[model samples]
Target: MRASKNRSQKSEVRSQNPKTYEIHISGAEGVYEDAEILKIVKEYTNRALNHPKGKPDNIVITLEQIKQIPQKVPMLPVITLKCNSPDKAKEMIFQILSDIGVPARTIKNSFKILTSPRTMRGAAIILKESGVRVEPDRERGVRVSRLGIEKNTEKILVRKLSKMKVSITTVKEALILASKVAAYTDVIAEICISDDPDYTTGYIASKRLGYIRIPNIKSHGQNYGGRVFIVRENTNINRLIKYLEKTPIIISGDIN
Candidate 1:
């Protein structure tokens, strides 16, 4: 009877371990530096150590930055510290782990942050909480989708751009514009431009499609990204016109 019970326990353990998941981590826009990211990771690790639940076994850390390369590295659950700069932090942590005889590796230019090791209570707790289900599509994918910008239009446009075979230059410009527009409105707007000698014609085409090109607005600043101008909810055109005429117009989308 004792032998049978031990076998059952081993089976349960095998069933609970999931092979992989899509994980990401990022700091508040403009607030994320290597040091800040390290701090967050350290805090998470410490909390896991003291957690009443089990501790995580193997951890993977991925660092992400804009216009910069990303880095991925393995981490030790016990001795690793949190990082501020994702790159430097992960490198330092990896070095420490290596000194202590932990196996680890580092990868560069990763598009996403790391979220792994189940964080405290070990694999058993993670298996319980995550309900350990295996999907064939979960492995070895790009890390670009981890950044959660709330606008739906931006998401759609980004997806659309990813499918096309456009030149990198055009794609870059489109991504910049799409990101700026997505900041203000929930509607996903899309743009497709053909090679045209006359820039005015292209501008006219964009305007005809209800996309008003923002002029003199910095890409990252307020007041000049893609903004939606609408009057109000349940308001008639005449009332909207009157309001626009009388008030300093601040046009957001259909405000509830």
Candidate 2:
């Protein structure tokens, strides 16, 4: 009986085809980090293996280090997939890794992450597990989705803006002007104003114009000075132009 069992085990090991290949995933930071990649890999692997009844053979996997790459190429990291049948495993990996960027390839030891490069710090594993949607923040240098902003914007803005002086009058005026501009133009992101000492008045004017206040503006004095306000990229240029022309607040220098 013992001899027969040994033979059966050996035969199974030999007959079982192992799949080996690489899967490119988001890097170990930002939206998709190491933990997220690993979790997704494991899920795919299990699915590929079909949840075998008995102990499964160990499949060797390698993770490529995260790094920045050209904009034409993806910035995510590569995760190598190994199994008895590379082709089968590749298909499974593609099916399982949805929302996350996945590249196609043949039987290989390694793959590359072909998505936007992201910083791995503070990456939320829940997102990976749930496959949450993400939107790019091209202007702010961050990868934030609508859900992410909705969840944290109030808290974040309140804390950051609390220290800075905010005049209700100025804020109301900025909002009114900004609303008109937003309706007239294709601006999606809010207009940003600098808070330099000399530009305080301009900043206030911008606020009164109804533009969203961007945090971390250089400190400005209580009164408006000759500071230049920058209309952030991707904003409604027409609206901004109209506001500039219609608004009476001077950003060039202090009004005498």
Candidate 3:
């Protein structure tokens, strides 16, 4: 994995000011186990701390040590969200709508239980206790619908947002109405995710919506080099806006 380059690509996805970043678990691989590795690190640290001056035994690495590491966050990564299969699309839809600062409620996560009567009853009780409404269905174990979320729309440009935002995670089995919308992490407020200029729905949508900021893939030909689609120059954003307005496309999804 070109970790550096991959980070650049994901940065292009715009997000709302997401203070609560979800915890991500990346697999760890090593010849040593966790205990062994911890021991080695402790020893190395103690030696470095003492250096030329002899250090006391008490001044050693403690168990309560905190480590900070530099890393990258994915651009609106949806696959990482914690939700059941059926409610995944609802999660994405609501997240996208909310991020764009649209005041819309009642569009997320409903569960349809298909377990036996005993199991379903137990599940229903738990959900009800958690303040999630559940109703009995003759055909299904239990039926739950509609998720309500709080969205405060502060009229602002979609782009130029500088913090990690939680976006929708389109799952493999998700199907939105009549359209076969593919599951992807749709960047909050901004939706352009393709490197292909031919595919321009998101760009056009942003223009029409008056949210001028849009994402473009990093390209050397255009001299727009970065990991993701970021307008490095403030003036460059204006330049692109002009270029996109005059640029022509043969179809709705196509762009110059």
Query: Which candidate leads in lDDT?
Result: 2
Tens digits of per-residue lDDT for model 3, 68-137: 2211111111222333332343345345545545334211111122111111211121121122322233
Give Cα distance to truth, residue 21, candidate 1, Å: 13
The window of 10 residues in a row where model 2 has the poorest summed lDDT is: 70-79
Candidate 1, position 181, lDDT: 25
Q: Candidate 1 at residue 237, lDDT?
A: 34
lDDT (tens digit, per residue) of candidate 1 on 90-191? 355335334433333211111011222211110010011122212112332111122222234335544554664433333333333333322322212221
Question: Alpha-carbon error at 207 in model 1, in Å?
Answer: 27
**lDDT of all the models against the reference?**
0.26, 0.27, 0.22
lDDT of 2 by residue, 1-256 (tens): 0000012333455566634322211111112245576774665455334421222343333444434321111111112223334244334434433212222221011112111132111111111222222222221222111110111422443343444455532342333333332332332212223212333222212222333233223233321111112232344443444333333221111111
What is the overall TM-score of model 1 with all chains considered together?
Answer: 0.21
Q: How many residue pairs clash (N, CA or C atoms closer than 3 angstroms) in each of the candidate models, in the order given?
A: 17, 30, 4
Candidate ordering by lDDT (highest first): 2, 1, 3
> Residue 235 in model 3: shift from native, Å?
16
